[model samples]
Each structure stands twice: as C-alpha cells, then as structure tokens.
Target: MTGLSPDARAWLEQHGFIPTDDAVWLEALTHGSFNGSGPADAADYQRLEFLGDRVLGLSVAAWLFRAGDAPEGKLSQRLNALVSGTTCARIARSIGLPEHIRLGKQARDDGGADSDKILGDVMEALIGACFIEHGFDTAQGLIYRLWAKELEGDVGKAKHPKSALQEWAAGNRRAPPVYTVTDRSGPDHAARFTVEVSVRNVGNAEATASSKGEAERLAAKAFLERFG
Candidate 1:
C-alpha cells in the first residue's frame, strides 16, 4: 500500500507514461505528513517538488517561446497563469491525483488529498520524477500533452483573479477584498498557506497554496466562482 495503487497504474497507462522508478513516483505522490511517525529517512515529495517546479517552468517557457512572437511581458503573464498553483491543482484533480496521494491520518482527515497545496506540490514532484527517471523530453511530452488545451489560444487574455476580484468588489460598491491567513504548514523552505478572502456584504472563500500570495489569489478565484 506504500506503493502505487491499481488506479494509479491505470491512470499512468492511460496517459502513456511508464515510470522507470516506481519508488520515485511513489515518493512524488507522498506528503510530509505521511512521514510524521515513520523512519527519519522516509522520503516525501519535497525535494522532488523543488526540482519539478523548475522543470515545469522550463517546459512552459520553451513552449511560450515557440508558440508565438509575443513580447517577454506577455509570455511571462501567460507562463504565470499556466504554472500557477491553481492550474497545477486543477490538473492534479483532473488526473485523479488526489486518490493516489499519501497522507497521514490527520492530514487525510483535514482533506489534504484534495488540498490545493498538497495537490499542486505532488503534481510538481511527479514532474520532477519524470525528468529524473526519464529525461526532459519525456517531461516535456507530458507537460505538452496535459497542457495542450491551455496552450492552444491566447492565454494572455485572462486577467489575474486577484485584480478581477478587487474590481468586482469596487464595481458592486462592496468593501474591498480582505485576505487573512488562516493557517500555515510545512517547512520554511516550502511553506503551505491557507488564506480566506472576504468582501463584506458579498461573500467569502478560502484556498490553500504554496505561498501566501498564491493562496490569496486562489481564495479570490473561489470567491468569484461563488459570488463574484
């Protein structure tokens, strides 16, 4: 049970991915919570998550470069939108990553499997494993395939949800959006933040992410979805 489940294997197969090191992939799907009482050496996804972040960045950058002749600023915006924790969590949820995630009892009880922070981190860690065990080409292939729809058209058209949320509040004559950090977890190198965004007399929403800023943005997006 410490390894991949049958559903995970089938999911990988459906995506045409055959991992060379099951251990690495398993580690990629693990959360630090899973190691709370285990051996000190028990590996989790943190290190892999670090590497995967860079890999995904590089892959997306390259795609942006070849995709069009937009200026660096436009490409940067598109890149940020594409690789944001929001996008990662969406992809993770789409690929059924939550069910495969390994978490401690407390984390599982806290809904860590479906958490944006955990899902996004594990998604990057999986990419890192792919890059290490296979190569950049393999990782790029995976990225390209999964992100085709996002890469299809003008990805630069979307406004950042934070700005949009604030604008919505102003337009509706509600109080400005207020963000509050509800919780933080993980080590200093990779902190996970949970933020709540509220607009008085309007609505409130919460989200979790790798950084406070990202968490705030996600919370804003959730708020928009609920009552923008």
Candidate 2:
C-alpha cells in the first residue's frame, strides 16, 4: 500500500511476506475500530489473530522441543512466556510494526497505536497474513527470526515474575503479596489498568497494563525489582 514505508515493505519482504492479495495484508494491519464504531466489515485482524495464535504456539513448541532437552514442564513455562502479549508487543515494537497499523481517527488520537493490546494483536495478525500469503514453513521461519532473542534468553529466567515473587515471599516469611486494582481508565475497547503489589514491610510497586492480569504481573515484577 501507498502508506507503507519502503523500510516496512522491505521488512515484510525479509520476513517472506509478499502479498499477492494486498487486501488481506491490509486487513491484517487494520483495527476493528478503524471504522470508529466496530469493524467496518469482516476485514479486520481478529480472525487473523486467532490463526496466528495457533501458528505461533505450534512454531514455538516445535522449535523449543528441538532446541532444548528440557522436560515438558520447563518447556511449557518457556512457551507461555515467549507467547505472552508482553513479549509479542516487544517483538512488534522492535520491528516498528506499530507505525504500519491503521486506526480510526478516534482510536489513533486515543493512542491506540501505542496500546500493547493492539500491537500484540497486530503482530499476530501480521504473522497470520504471512502464513496465508506464503505457508507454514515460511511463517515459521519468520517467527523464529522475530522471536530469536526471546527464544534464546535464559529459560529459567523465563519463569513468571508472579511465581518468583510468591516464592520470595514464602521464603522470607512475609505475607503473600497482595495485588489491588488501583485504577481503570481509557475507553472500553482500549482500557488500561493500574495495579499495585505489596508485601508487608518489604516493599510495594505499581504498574499499568492493558489487562488486569498483565498489570498484576507487572506490578509483581516491579515489586521484586525494587525490593527483592
């Protein structure tokens, strides 16, 4: 499309995405709110996101199985961390995908392009588009390339921060950390939550995210960083 930058086009090409039908790829970058009410039609990213989620799961699982000799539990943990929305958004940002996303006037003005939820979904949809245009092997190669850093990171560190924090609390003889939703704001479609995690006498930290669960996880991570 005309709006896509030369670099973006090149990046897509590098990822093996050369769309014969531009409409599908364009739809992959389009938000449901692009029409300002809901999806203007069926040509939005949700269905693509659904497909991409599975594709990502399979690709990551297969890669991990071959890449490591870890047992199933460790592999599952690593896979969950790798496929999380936070990780997806990180990958999307690394590739400048946010700039390619199409949003409605209101959504754009509301910072939809910067929303982790939108970026993560768009990343998945983009992968789906790659799969559709190319095929599984090509899409898997793209996933591996995009996700290389995460896949190669210390697997033990891939343990969930909340789990680590809870273990820290138990070992330190402190009350289990408590998380409270301190704030919820923004449009319903793009709501943000601020959560606080506190362990008595040790420390407390707060973080904001697109979902309550993510907010809680981030808050726990922050608390551990600050105090543990």
List all candidate RMSDs to the true structure.
5.1, 2.9
lDDT tens digits by residue: candidate 1, 1-228: 355677887877676567656788878877888887554555899999999999999999999999779888778889998887878988889878888887887778767787777888888998899899888999999999987877886554587789899899989988999999999987543568999999988779999977899889789999999996
What TM-score does each of the candidates earn? 0.74, 0.86
Candidate 1: regions farther than 4 A off = 1-3, 37-40, 153-156, 161-211, 218-228
For each candidate, what is the lDDT? 0.84, 0.85
On the 0 to 100 scale, the lDDT of residue 62 in model 2 is 99
Best by TM-score: 2
Model 1's TM-score against the true structure: 0.74
- Cα lDDT tens digits, model 2, 100-186, are 787888988888888888998999998898899888998899899889888888644566889999999999999999999999999
Off by over 4 Å in 2: 1-11, 37-42, 200-203
Candidate 2, 222: how far from true, in Å?
A: 2.7
